[model samples]
Target: MIKVEQLSFSFPQKELYTNISFTLEEGQHCAFIGTSGSGKSTLIDILMDPDRYLFDGRLEMEPGCSIGYVSQFAQPDTSADTTVFEYIGASFIKLQNEIESICSEMETSSDIEPLLDKYQLALDAFDAMGGNDFESNIHKQLNLANLMKRRDLKVSDLSGGEFKLVQVMKEMLNRPDLMIMDEPDVFLDFDNLNALKQLINSHKGILLVVTHNRYLLNHCFNKIIHLENMEIQEYDGRYIEYNFSLLQTKIELQELTLAEKEEIERNENIIDNLRAIATYNSEASRGRALKARVKFQERLEARRIKAPFVDIKQPEIHFGIDHDVQDLTVLKVDQYRAAYDELLLDKVSFEMKSTDKVALIGPNGTGKTTLLRDIANNHPDSITLHADAKVAYLSQLQGEVLKDSNTLLEEFIDAGMSTYDEIRAHLAGYGFEREILNQRIESLSGGEKNLLQLAKVAVSNADLLLLDEPTSHLDTYTQIALDQAIQDYKGAILMISHDFYSVVNGMDYVLIIDDKTVRRMTIKKFKKMIYARHFDKDYLELEQQKKALETKIELALKATDFELAQSLMDELEALIKLL
Candidate 1:
């Protein structure tokens, strides 16, 4: 059990949570939620590294309680040229090494066997840890991922999302008492996300995950610790339930406030009447009436109710889409192909109309982002857009587009928005303050930067909008705002996002990138397809072919046989085409 009370935290520039209290007792699986950059991650960090963060609070963990945390911010040695299998099976290796050490010592100290007892103990520990079958477990995990063929692939060769998955897999293998995962939903498609969900549900240990996934929060977490306004509020149950109850309470409070106001008005009227009566009567009566009225006023003041919540300033997002009518087909792709390390998309064909709202979704490292960028760059003959179409793109990589010289305020202005007052007022609706306007672009939180991009999108009169992971940094309400805006948007939008709820309701259709297939279907159909696609097969075969071809090509090159090397390279490419 872990109990936290009256916790207050501050960073170099901002104070986060103050006087916050919550508990993660046995059998209570929970989640952390708040506005983007509202210090949800900071709270998790405080829990993971209690000695690192300075805070004023009472935090007590059960004695000898173990914790296994998985966070996106965690850095593994990715630069090392280690195979996926070797890296994932590292725990087994460490155990084997320990066992070998004990045995060697035992052999050295014979005839009374000083190290014999230690050796037996070590062997028992290894057995308990399932050291004998751990290698097979690693193989099993890889097979589940349809990555058995890539087991020999170097860690450095995998995509960013793939690396994250590998690290998470390693942590899951550890299986400690308490597990904390921060944004595990990012970079994962519906298939991998479901797999992760199953794993979390099956784990008997306590889980404290911080994710923007609405489905996961409502389904997995039994409790929610909400961080807001430098304070914390604990909800006893799921998000949907808590939000509903909170709404009911807010309504009741509003009604009660109105009733109290009416009561105060009636009392004032009575007091006025009494005063009037005394004014026409004698001096003694007048003085008595005044005193009575003062007492009555004091009582009314005592009975008055304070408002339950402060009015939170939220930034408003409104996209002013291009109004000019143009060609029906805004964009089209014919036989598109691009690759980083492996084949991402091949012979992919698609077309989008002027008013179409589409979502592109796929598993991690499946090239959703690459496809979007290829379209945006209008990659030579691969992509075709209507000559007159105006385009606006909000990339998932906000930091890449934004420059160091610009402040949040400047970016808003440079995006062709109106006066600073108009822009700042708009930002204020999304929770930006006056002080936040002057902050450097780099200093802004992920959500804040995302909002800034949305704010820019709001002013642009582009006919087609390309948004990648737009809802990643948005809080629930903010996501709702964006969703509504997208729904009402006149122009078309092609987005790449993992926001399940938004993608389901906001977009007209979905474009699922499953390996080499580019499927255009409704959200419902897309989900069903992904569910069926989750069965991992065909991967091992293609990967083996790729590996063998790569080995031959390398050997040929090493022998200085250019003709043979070229032939092998061609074979490798053909194998990749199959994948």
Candidate 2:
């Protein structure tokens, strides 16, 4: 159990929290949702190190209990040359070393009397801490994630998603009493996301997580802690339920009651009478009486119902010129093959009409970004655009679609906007303040850079927009803003995003890339296919083979036999090729 009382936090220039309180008990999954830089990370930092900074708060963590923390964009130890297996065992090194030392002493000692007791005690301690089954837990998670092949791969060679999985697996294998994860669903595909969800659900521990993934919020968590406008709002239900209640509360806060309206009217009448007396009656002795009456009425007049805080306005994105395409057929692709050092996509074909709103979705390490880049770079055989089509691309991978050396102000100016004030006004919709105008593109966080690209796209005169993971790092409010912009867009849009909410709400068509099969259909049909996996014989057979291979690889790795693990990998690869 963890208890936070009257918690207040501060940085060099900002006060993040003021008098916030909450209690998180075991077996409860509570999430923190807010806009970017709303102090979710800072609160996690405070929890990780209670005495690291000065704050007016009492954070009581249960004594002797362990904690596991997986921060956002948390990387593995790349400098240290180690495999996934070795990295997972890094935490248990001390116990293993102690056990080895005790056994060595017992074997060498002549008397062997004292050494025997020491060895027994050390073994008991190691066993009590679950040191014997540490690798077993790791292998289980790795197999479930279908990452058993990555066990022998070096930490430095891991992709971002792979590194995140390894770090999470280590934390889970540690068996901490509490697990705190930040943005765990940032770049996950369906399979890995399901693995993470299953892991969280199976863990019988307290979970205090912070994420913007709506699926996780709606399905995984039962409680929500929302920080907005410098206020903390606690909801007793899950994400959907909390949203419903939040709408009702906002309506109540905005509307005035009949009694309150009448009270305001009465006060206005009193103020009018008092002002009349003060203005007309100008006698010397009675002047003080009139002044007092006016002052009292003024006070009463000032006292009215204080309006609730309103959120900052969502960014108004005017995406592209309102030029409708007469020909209608915006783009066409036939038998597309994209490759960068390795084959990313093979034999994939798709098309887009002038009014189409499509989403291309796949796993993190797949060729979604590669396909977008090929289309943007105007590959000969891949893209067939109309003569009048104007193409604009937004890549979440920084420096791909933008020059990082340029300042935000410079970028906005290059977008053909008028003046500095106008630029700030435009950027403000994406949560940019005046201070950030002069900041360079490289200095911004991933989320901010993505938003800057969005702002640029908003003002462009493109008839087609190809976006890759546009909402990966944005907060909830900014995502909603972008969704609205996409809805209002006149041109055809083809985007690649892992955000379920954005994909469901903003996209009319979906292109699902799974197991090398590309399926483009209505979002409604794809959703049905996802929920009810009544796939064809080929897909079902491939899935069954993959599961069986994963199980076999899991058992082999649990025994820590490298030869067997490698053999299973060879077989798994052969089986994948057959698919």
Candidate 3:
């Protein structure tokens, strides 16, 4: 448990937060929700006592406490030459050492057996912590990240997303009493995100998360803390509540503005009447009226009404048109086998039509990215496309294109051709400021850089687009904007994303990759298949009959009819086997 009492902090040139008071009850899970640059991370740092910024209040912890923090970026010290397994396994090693020390202190007792039991417990803990599945999970996460083949590679060799996944696994293993994570869903696919949600739910300590991922925020956090305009406010419910509260606040402000305008007009009318009477009378009796009018004017001038400027402007995006097709087959892969020491993708063949919006869907390590890259590489030779077909590829890590020397604006300009004003206006749509436009690309956050990347591509004229995890670092509003833009595009889209909502809502067709093979299905049919597998609805009448038999067996057992119960149980088991 922790408490912040009247905590105030300010920067040298700007006020960050003031009079921020909040408490985290034992086992409370809270989320910090606010726009970027709202001091969320800064507040986390203050809570953890890392680097002391300007402040004027006290943060109190309940007696002695330990805290664990997971940053947005991976901070693994590459100079130490550590593998992913070694990094995660160290937590267990420390816990095991502590258990051994405690066991040695309790000498000569029957508790020895129970103490030794801890070793088995530790082993089970390790296994459950993903020890045996460690390498597989790593490979899966990396492959979903489009960097699987580089397992033996050093930490420094990984891209940003790859390294971020490694750090996420490490944090999951730590399992600290007080855990604070900044964007835990950063590089995770759907399967891994589900795993992470389970881990967080099963965690027995405090969880303080700051993430823009709506699903995670809605599923995990019970309370929301919003930071805005140098103040921290608490919302009583989840993300949806917070969103509704924001809308409510806007409406309240509008009402207040109307009230203030009416009040001002009423005061002006009174003042006008008083002034007119005073001017006509020219007598000392009218002095009190004039004084009352002056006082009203002063009160009106002194009144401070709250009014916030909300920008509701939407972006104007123009998607390129699809030209006439020269051939129906847009892409094909025949007898394609690509792997590294082991087969990742084997003999996969697929054909694409002109208007196809194909989604590559699968679990993390099924080599979805490999299949996509293979398609992109084999597109020219294996299949014929429209004569004017142009492809725009957006990789998961846009840092490859954003070099260190290039400014945000400079990178947009270098994307080949765009007018100066056009580039500026487009960047503004993506939340880039004039000051940030001149900032070095290397200095921007992952989310900011990704937005700039989208801005570049959105302005480009291309008939076919290939996007890999385009919604990874985007906020909900930005994600909706992207969804709208994609829907408006007449061009064919080939995308790989882990956001289930985006996939379900936007995709028309899906390609399921499993065990080195690709299975094509319509989105509706795929949903039905998934439901059938999960709930045994594949054969609806058979499932219903099985349920009826199960209920009859339960009733028979309650009636103390041994023969009937036994017979029914046996028949039910047989039916289960047959199904």
Candidate 4:
């Protein structure tokens, strides 16, 4: 439990917050949602007391409460000579030591028996804290974080995703009263995202999470704290409530705009009357009226006015007319197989038309990227496409391209472009200002680098676009702009993305990958399948049975019924197999 009152913080150039107040109750799960650069991270740092930013606030925290924090870019302890098991098992060791020390003291002195009795509660507390399921939980989370395969490997050899998983596991092992996670879903795939959701849902402690993943936010959060315009506002309900509240705010803003317009007109009339008096040679009266007019004009200008939202302007794309390829297939793949001990894609075959806008969709690790690479490689003959068919690829790992030793502007010009002004203008459209345009490519953030790549691809006048997770680090507003740009492009597209809203709204065809096979379907048909699989009566019944079984297992463990726990676990495993 934590409470803040009259919080204020400011920087030299901008004020981030003023007179903010909020309370986070024990065992509450709250999400901080807002636009980029809106001070969400700043508030988190203030709460954690990491660095002394300019601030004036009274924070009342629960006495003796411990807080565990996981940052967005947490790196694994590579220098430590410890296994994953040893690291996670350390928590149990500490708990055991405390319990033993209390018992020893009680045995040595009769005066300590009452205190010893209080300490004796540790074992039950530990058990209730998921001590029995600790190993399973660690394994589950590691697998979800894409660290399971490397569990036996040293931390130094683990990938970014593995390091993130380890950090999450470490926070969970501490069993703190409150957990604060910033961008926990940054490097996670869909499987890990689901695992994280399940972990959070089952967790008993309070959680404050900051993430831009809509899927995670929609599924896990019950309360939303929206930070905007240097103010904090709370929504009593979940994601839906936050969204509806935003809509209401927009309506209120419209009404406010109308009232301000009327006020502006009134002020203009007063200024006109003052001018007429000045023309009639009434110097004293005119001067007094002019002063009044000037004061009113200043007040009107000082009022914070919201700029009217205008959609991003998409440039007219003309895929140069080279040749009529009505009969030529734009893409073709056959007998593609890739795997590490298991086939991820087995003998997949598909063809793409010049006009096809296909979306690749599946659960994580189902070989979406592998399939794309295979298609891109096998279609070399199709490369010399329609004279106007220039191809531009946007991969998830586009940051790798930024490793080149060139300034951002230099790279844009070197990529077959001619004009510096054109490059600067396009980069600015993607939120990069002139100062950033001259910076080295390696100095940019992931989001900025992504935007640069998109700008380059867009300017190439490519007729065929290949995008893989293009919207990962982008905010919702930017995503909408990108969607509009893609919609207006007079070219075909093959994209692999996890953003469901964009995929559903922009795609015309769906290609579902599952169990090493590919099935092409219309978007309408794919939607029907998803609806039936997730929301049908039979699926609901199955889900209810699964929940009941999970509850039974939890009760068995809490009761110290190991045999029952094992039985229930076995039954649950069988039920999962059936599903």
Write one digit per residue (lDDT tens) for candidate 4, span 436-536: 57767775545556667777777666657788777766555556567667766656788887565566667888888876787888876765665553233
Candidate 3 lDDT over residue span 113-166, tens digit each: 776776678767766555656556555555543444555567654444456655
Q: What is the lDDT of residue 136 in candidate 3?
A: 64
Clash counts per candidate, in order, are: 5, 0, 0, 0
lDDT of 2 by residue, 349-402 (tens): 788888789999887766887778878885677678887888888986668777
Q: Which candidate is the best by TM-score?
A: 1
Candidate 2's TM-score? 0.79
Decide which is better by TM-score, 2 or 4: 2
Ranking by lDDT: 2, 1, 4, 3
Query: What tens-digit string does per-residue lDDT give for candidate 1 at 40-134?
Result: 87788888778997799888997777787777555457679888888887877877898788766666665636577767777787787677887
TM-score of each: 0.80, 0.79, 0.69, 0.71
Query: What are the per-model C-alpha RMSD values against the true structure?
Result: 16.1, 13.6, 13.9, 13.1
lDDT of each model, Cα atoms only?
A: 0.73, 0.74, 0.66, 0.68
Q: In candidate 1, what residue range of length 10 has the lowest lDDT sum? A: 306-315
Model 1: which residue pairs collide?
314-429, 314-430, 315-429, 315-430, 315-431
